[model samples]
Target: MTAVPLSDDIALRIGLAARILPEIGVARLLRVLDSALGLPPTADTLERLRLRDLRQGADGALADLEPERLKDALAILRGEVGDTQPPPLPEPYVEGELPGSIRVACASDSGEQLDGHFGAARRFLVYQVSTAEIRLIEVREIDDGRAEDDRNSYRAGLIADCQLLYVASIGGPAAAKVVKVDVHPIRLGAGGEIREHLRALQDVLAGHAPPWLAKVMRQGVAPAGGAA
Candidate 1:
């Protein structure tokens, strides 16, 4: 099959969208786009793409996908989902201000929820968390313009300061990149409110932390004074 030529911008969007849509890869998505948009897909075609177009073009390719996930994926292709205006970050935190805290990065698409895959998240919501407090310290938007080959590495570097990363899903290679940067990846298969995970971390901070977490805390400042 002759490969359809895609503009860089459209290609980047499709790449990210493919990651958002489970079980769909870039090549399959391109085939669907080719069928739906006819020949090479342009920015206009992508913007004009609708759910019906996707369904018709998919032709069983996406039959098993959840409706909402498909919609979100389509929205990404249509440029409706992104870090156009990122979520507000809390007051800046100096390192020692949250001495017992460890920095965490959450893969979020909508800001409130941890509902993004590592490779496709719109932004990384960075937080400083301890037993007593969880504060949003930074919001790092993904730079989609980076070359595709090193994009995963770039994303890993985005939150290198954090000791832990929370994502709804992450590929093994991407998770390996994250771990290489000393950030532990935590997958919440059923992604939920970011605060809920942080609060759970707080509970762990308040009690006997697991060995891995204890090591992380020691690397940073220290665990909560009373932590076992």
Candidate 2:
């Protein structure tokens, strides 16, 4: 049977899908187009014809084709193109002082939660802190292998470490005095300004912590005390 001519809408949809879904293979692309355009089931002959048109268009070998056919042919041509893998993440910046706003690094082994918040992120850092120089921390790329339990453990460990650093800086007697103080309600701004607020908090704790405790507080951490 002679193949039916593609419609403008179908052609457009196919072209867009090919441009958008470069990872999709030609066979799969055809199937998706067929399903989306309500076209009849695809077969080997149709696939071969589509592939031929695609090759011709890609090599600038096609001319004088109908608009609808040209659209589909262009899509096929694009589908044949391949892309390289994404480049590796760049090194973390540590030229300036670490932000003090009680920064929390949240992650999971599954990568689901991180993906969900991808667009919402303003600034993220992978930090490495030592026991002796707890104040000096280095940021690195987010590790994907850290499981949920590991993340929870890291949170608790960070809180404990920060408290220790705070105590060491302030000395035992003074550290004990304000150990029970509650600082909370951390306010974050809409843009990158929130990181500055965190840095300000860090500056406040410089050389002020006791060896036994990190900075501890609850409530009133937010910028302008606004609700997140």
Candidate 3:
């Protein structure tokens, strides 16, 4: 998308923000800009404006949005709900510890595959993936008895302790919601066995890990200098 150029200061701030918030793809950035600043929704809009315009527009637009909508928008801009880190994860595979455990949740109809959407799914099969092995943690039942203002975020909260959420599909807002809670969402084209996903995650942990995962790991990793 050909977005109008921003001034140097704005560009620098955006670049730095994008470094930490990888989910803010160019498409999303443009969409947020249009939504927040009243620019044309399409990326090819010819409106020339500076970052200050975007900032002002976002601040004003945010005031009118509902809380959940505001969260999604802020997530787009800052990369997280409030930039607060999750509790420290345990080491890669601490035998009985939860500190660095990489817990994952998968939405499924049969409780066996990634077969459900975040909004419609009634349950999630949880797993703990470590460098050496993957184990079934538990079956997380979604509380849909009552209606929620933001179904996506509500579902994400169901597996708040998890680091990743796998589903057959997810919308952009749902994805953002999970990302806000420090749970990276993964979508599958079709349903697959829960074990298969765990195996794949195990393989990734054994290897060098991707950029997103590397960052996730670093978030859990403790600083050597902090040791007494």
Candidate 4:
């Protein structure tokens, strides 16, 4: 089947909805939308879609989903929901300032929580972590406007500087892309507070740097001083 082109706004909406319903892949969900709302589903048509519409078209993909899940997914598609506002970022640091620290990127939909899929996350909360401390240094928003064919590559590129990535879930292909960029991806199946995860990382850093982590620490360049 020929793919339908979607406007940036509509594409972003679909991405957010996919995050909510990870059980359904984006391609399959798009097929469901096409089936339910006709070819080339738009924000307007999706806003008008009712639960019955999805049930009739999902072809069992969404059959086991709870009503609440359906509602949330629909709300996201309609732009009724918004991305979470991240907490205030800590002061920036120089590249080599945090000695023995590894840069980590956390996929997040909710502010300060690692509750997002690698492909569909709204933003990446980046942290500079060392055994001594963890600092939030940057928040990179995903560009859902990119072409669908290379969207995962684009997202992975955004955090290419980070040494590690944390997400609630990530597909095999997406994980491969992340690995290609030299960023190790970690899946936290049940997401939790960003600080908690970072603290655990600190524990690992303070104790024994695993062979893999020790390598990452060595890969980091020393800071040139001054805020970055």
The candidate maximizing lDDT is 1
Model 1 root-mean-square deviation: 8.2
Scanning candidate 4 in windows of ten residues, the lowest lDDT window is 219-228
- Write down the lDDT that model 3 would get: 0.56
lDDT of 2: 0.30
- For candidate 3, the TM-score is 0.53
lDDT of 4 at 11: 89
Residue-level lDDT for 206 in candidate 1: 95
How do the residues 42-114 of candidate 3 rate in per-residue lDDT, one tens digit apiece? 2223234333434455444323333433332333343221112222222243434545457777876563656
RMSD of each: 8.2, 19.3, 15.6, 7.9
Model 3 clashes, total count: 4
Query: For each candidate, what TM-score against the reference?
Result: 0.67, 0.23, 0.53, 0.66
lDDT of 2 by residue, 5-82 (tens): 655544444544343233443445565435333344233233444534433433333333333333333433333211
How many backbone clashes can be found in candidate 4? 2
Over 4 Å off, model 2: 1-136, 148-160, 163-191, 202-228
Give one digit per residue, the lDDT tens place, for model 4 in 6-80: 898888888778865666868888988888888788867988988777777757567676564566577677665
| lDDT values, one for every candidate | 0.77, 0.30, 0.56, 0.77
Clashing pairs in 3: 89-99, 89-100, 90-99, 90-100
What TM-score does prediction 4 earn? 0.66
lDDT pick, better of 1 and 3:
1
